[model samples]
Target: MLIDTHAHLNAPEFAEDRDEVISRARENGVSTVINIGFNRETIPTCLELAERYEFIYAVIGWHPQDAKDMTDADLEWIAELTRHPKVVGLGEMGLDYYWDTSPKDVQAEVFRKQIRLARELKLPIVIHNRDAHEDVIKILREEKAEEVGGVMHCFSGSWETAKLALEMNFYISFGGPLTFKNAKKPKEVAVQVPLDRLLVETDCPYLTPHPYRGKRNESGYVRLVAEEMANLRGLPYEEMIQITGDNAQRLFRLPARS
Candidate 1:
């Protein structure tokens, strides 16, 4: 079985055929998917998808890009949702210097608040870092995020950064970019992450993989990422799938297959 460790199936890109895309994911061996809702708008929709499908789960938080829009009430809403049976984690949260839509200080404050909340709730966090590696790491460290270790979603940083996150007890997840022929850094880090600390995802409807690089992505495409990871690590494809699936389940505290 495979688990898409991170995805946004609630995104408008799949509105036309979300069910079929989910069906295709099952056919492609994706047994579970962790969908993210990173803003006021998506939180409810994210929960709806998870509640609709037994195998789909949810991760809720504020996106760094939308950091400026988040409010005390919104953070409280996320805290309340943590009680939902299918709500598995507390993020897609972190700093995003690339867009700079929110002031860096604001993004950092929001990121810190979410991390602190995750710690309070004892839930793992799913981080989204975009060109703000140093600050992200610094904040995670200052917040003592290791107390509630999480995944560094769609990680695209250097091996050194990967090592630092690993040191802080976080899993390193690789996505579509690892399959790109020219994505040297991600490919390098993908091969080096300890198998037990490794995870894979599609981050679909975005970051589509190799042959489908320019097309819309779906969870089924995560298999391509697993295949590339297997090739890079010199392991059998099925073995790679098993390893990542197991790691995902363990980190997310997912129930074991019967």
Candidate 2:
């Protein structure tokens, strides 16, 4: 079974046929999906989706792009939601220099806050990083994020950076980019990341995998990502499915399903 460890089915792109999308995911062998929260508006939707679907789970926190808008009250509210059984982690949080919707300083401030919160709650975090790897790693190190560990979602870095993250007890999650024809770095990292430290995601509603590029992505397409990981690591497709699915299950503390 495949587990899409990262996805955004809560986005408006799925509003028209969300149910059908999820059903297609099950048909395609996706046994579980973790919906990630990017901001205030999507947090509730993420929780709702988790509640509505037995196989769906949620990770809630502010995205780096929306860091400036996050508030103390928002942090408290997120803490409250962590009481929910389906709130598996705290994040989708980190730095994003690609789009400075919030000042870099503000982004770092909020990122550390969430990291600290995740530690206190003993939940994993889902980090979102874009053109800000140095600071992200530095902060994670200083904050001692390894205490709770986390995932580097849609990892787009070199093996060296991945090694650093691994040393910090973080799993490296590959998304649709790993399947792109010209994505050399992600492919290289895919080959080097240990099987147990590897994970697969679609980051759906965006970064759709090959053959489906330019089209809206859904959780079902995680199979394509897993197949690509298998090809990169010279393993059978089903083996890739099992390893990555197990990695996600262990990381998110998800129970084994029949």
Candidate 3:
């Protein structure tokens, strides 16, 4: 069985046929899905999906793009929700320089707050780094995030960055980019990561893999990502799925599939 370490199955893109999408994922051997809920609008919906499906779990936090909108109450709200048994982690939170929707300083502060909160609750984090690797790493380091190490979701950074994150006890996760023909950096780094420290994802409703690029992504397509990862690591597809699935279970403290 496989686990989609990151996904947005709760996104509006799946509103029309979300059930079908989830069924397809299951049919494709995706046994578990870690869904991200990164902002006021999505947090509730994400939790709903987790509550609705036995195999779905939630990760709650504020997205850097919406950092300016987060308040003390929102943080408290997230803290309260983590008490839910299906809330597996705290994030999808980090710097996002590309969007620049939120000021870099605001994003950094919000990110720090979530990291601090995650540490307080003893929850592993799920990071979202986009065009802000240096600051993400710096803040993660300054905040001593290794205390509750996490996964670098949809990682698109260099090997050097991956190394630093790994040093901080972070698992390096790869998504659709790993399947791209010209994605040299991810391809290069995906092979070097120790199997135990590697994870796979779809980051669905976005980052759709090759052959399906330019189309809306779905959790089912994580199998394509796993296949590509298997090819990259020179392992059988089943073995790659087990390795990444096991890593996901370990990091999120998920129960073994019965």
Q: What's the number of clashes in each of the models?
A: 0, 0, 0
Cα lDDT, model 3, residue 28:
92
| Clash list (residue pairs), candidate 3 | none
Checking candidate 2 for backbone clashes, the offending pairs are none
Per-residue CA lDDT of model 3 for 20-58, tens digit only, reads: 999999999999999999999999999999999999999
Tens digits of lDDT, candidate 2, 52-125? 99999999998999999999999999999999999899999999999958999999999999999999999999
Segments of candidate 3 deviating more than 4 angstroms: none
- Using lDDT as the measure, name the better of candidate 1 and candidate 2: 1
The residue-level lDDT of candidate 2 at 85 comes to 96
lDDT of each: 0.95, 0.94, 0.95
Name the runs in model 1 displaced over 4 angstroms: none
The root-mean-square deviation over C-alpha atoms between each candidate and the true structure, in angstroms, is 0.6, 0.6, 0.6
TM-score of each: 0.99, 0.99, 0.99
Please report how far candidate 2 places residue 21 from its true position, in Å: 0.7
